[model samples]
Target chain A: MMNIPEDISPWLAIPVVLLLIGGSLITLIGTLGLLRLPHFYQRIHGPAISITFGAGSFLLASMLYFTVLQQRLVIHELLITAFVMLTAPVTAMLLMRTAVYRDLRNGRQSPDLKPPTPPASGHATTAGANSPGLMEETRDRNPE
Target chain B: MKLLVEIALYFSQFCIVLAMLLCMLRLLKGPTAQDRVLALDTLWICAMLFALLLGISFASLVYFEWAMLIALTGFVSSVALAKFLMRGEIIE
Candidate 1:
């Protein structure tokens, strides 16, 4: 087994401590947001905090600890980190879209009112009242 | 010094387990399918962290690898669930 020198102690310990505490706190915040946020779309922001910064910090701590202990570069942690960063936004986007679709299907308030009407159809048609076709259209336009 | 590390590892693991329990509460209490899916995602993250802590405590690389795979599969499943929620179908 390789040994890490004593000189590296201060450098390693501080960052590890920081990562551990910071990651835990962020995760707590995310959970709180999940619980406290009033609506599903609003609640979506909460886990983004965990998936991004919280996971990032944890991964940093792991990388530092293992690299120091093993006395070599440990890059496998990066694979997890990179996978998280790449997939988180995609998942969040999908969740958001799904929330919107569900709300629309149930005739709940539009979370955002900014999607201007299609140029050909100048007005935002209230799909709730008029057309079964509109429901099918929304589903088709944003297929799962 | 070994005892100190063990204590710290145990504490971290405990915190992660507590978080997972909170997530389970949300999963069970969720009023919407989307909310449950979010809780499931959160639970997966906690479990991955727990696995990492176990790996560190035991000085094992295999647990770390297992944690990585869990994260990957969790992401895929959450995305698929979200997609299903969106269009009421997962496949074309």
Candidate 2:
């Protein structure tokens, strides 16, 4: 995989190297966190770093390296950066929400799990972990 | 400097490959469905980064497009899976 072209300047290469190595290392740590962290919530944070800084640096390095090599601006990587940034949080939030609600549905207890906010102007306290509220039951129509 | 870049690229490639392996292990052994989905999301990101690294080492432009397409579709699948888990339906 060492097919990087010649004639590239040293100055352009240094930052690329630093960003590449640092980002890769960060991603490794984050993935380790996903695997080794004791809980789901803690494990979730691990990949956050991967999707953000890790991918960010890799794309940035790709941009810099290719821009220097091709002798023109190569900013298309930004589209990826933007997509990741925009979607990452939504994905993470939805996954966390799913995890929490599933645990509640199955009555799986976790100290990390926080109680949902009580609904306004209603007896929301009646909803227990195993017994979900009418609204929730209505929302999830397909029963397992 | 070329030598430094070469060495760094190799090392980074190795690291990302290792990271991808770790993510797969989590995907396989994650205690719950949500954990698995999260691992899948992370796996795609790792894969994308790996592609970018490959682009650098090979000096090819195709990997960049591959990375972009992966990035575009990965989030949708993750979100859809999570939605299915949450709502018991992907489209409803």
lDDT of 2 by residue, B1-92 (tens): 77888999889989998998998999888767788899999989988898898898899999989998898889889989999999889996
TM-score (chain B only), all candidates: 0.96, 0.95
lDDT of 2 by residue, A32-83 (tens): 9999998888898999988889999988998998888888999999999998
Worst 10 residues of 2 chain B by lDDT: B27-36
lDDT of 1: 0.73
Poorest 10 consecutive residues by lDDT, candidate 1 chain A: A135-144
How far off is residue B47 in model 2, in Å?
0.5
Top DockQ model: 2
Q: What is the lDDT of residue A115 in candidate 2?
A: 40
Query: In model 2, which residue pairs have backbone atoms overlapping below 3 Å?
Result: none
TM-score of each: 0.79, 0.85
Per-residue accuracy of model 1 over A42-126 as CA lDDT, tens digit each: 7778878877877788888888888887899997999998888898888888887887777666653353444434445634445
Q: What TM-score would candidate 1 get against the native?
A: 0.79
Candidate achieving the largest lDDT: 2
Weakest 10 consecutive residues of candidate 1 chain B by summed lDDT: B1-10
Model 2's CAPRI class is: medium
